[model samples]
Target: MNYLHWLSPDVDLSGDKAKVPTSGASFVKYFQPSPPASDPPHRYTFLLYAQPADFKMPKLASPLAFDLVSFAKAAGIGEPKAGTFMQVQG
Candidate 1:
């Protein structure tokens, strides 16, 4: 099964990694289209991948700056199986 880390724009995952849930290598979150006042709508995207038989979470300095393609290659997740996005207005 694949393991996923759900991230939010305002929520910090650095100290709350333990609270994140694990699924079939995928963790999904609701899309919040609305940003704070004076801010622009953020693009929320989902990146799906095929998890390897044996997988482990790699140490990341900043999860927010994570590169999807690079992570997939390092984790042996292969290319994204599917993807989608939504826009929220501030």
Candidate 2:
């Protein structure tokens, strides 16, 4: 599985700022996996939400780090499920 790191638009990817902080990690490290199969590799996902907004994820974390949706939920600043992203595969 490939590792992924995400940051809100607020965070800078310019490499001039400090490194980003992780809210979570892979499930493999946290849970047991099924035995290997004669099948293609499965895609496992790790989702990380930013900490509450009144507080920041962490300094030097992401100047712009923090998911707007998650932040809204954590802060109770907006309605739930107000927005979402969608994709269609051909």
Candidate 3:
């Protein structure tokens, strides 16, 4: 989906291993897995956010959105809003 006013930074995106300080707002909570079995199937879910289209990314890149909120604010996306979600089956 295309939001008409979000800006993103020009940076190399990587895995969560590169932990940025948690904003608490932008993170995983209440994550639960399915029922038990002889060999439980593996499963995972994730939430992703991006800047709106109108905003323009800065020259310097940010590792996480916790810091990027400042950038988003400047672009006019305001407090980053959570988008739609999807579910995965194991």
Best candidate per lDDT, number? 1
Q: Residues 1-90, candidate 3, lDDT per residue (tens digit)?
A: 111222223222377542433334322233344434554444332323454556554443433233454545565656533444443344
* RMSD (Cα, Å) of model 2: 11.5
Which ranges of candidate 3 are over 4 A from the true structure?
A: 1-53, 61-66, 83-90
Query: Candidate 1 on 1-90: residue-level lDDT in tens?
Result: 122336322222348442334333323344334467787766677654555658665555554455766666666767766579766677
- Candidates in descending TM-score order: 1, 3, 2
The 10 consecutive residues of candidate 3 with the worst lDDT sum are 1-10
Output the TM-score of candidate 3.
Answer: 0.26
As for TM-score, the candidate ahead, 1 or 3, is 1
User: Candidate 2's residue-wise lDDT over 30-77, tens digit each?
Assistant: 332332576555443333333344643322323233354554455454
What's model 1's overall lDDT?
0.52
As for TM-score, the candidate ahead, 2 or 3, is 3
- Candidate scoring better on lDDT of 2 and 3: 3
| Model 1 steric clash pairs | 2-25, 3-25, 33-88
Question: What is the C-alpha local distance difference test score of each model?
Answer: 0.52, 0.37, 0.39
lDDT of 2 at 21: 36
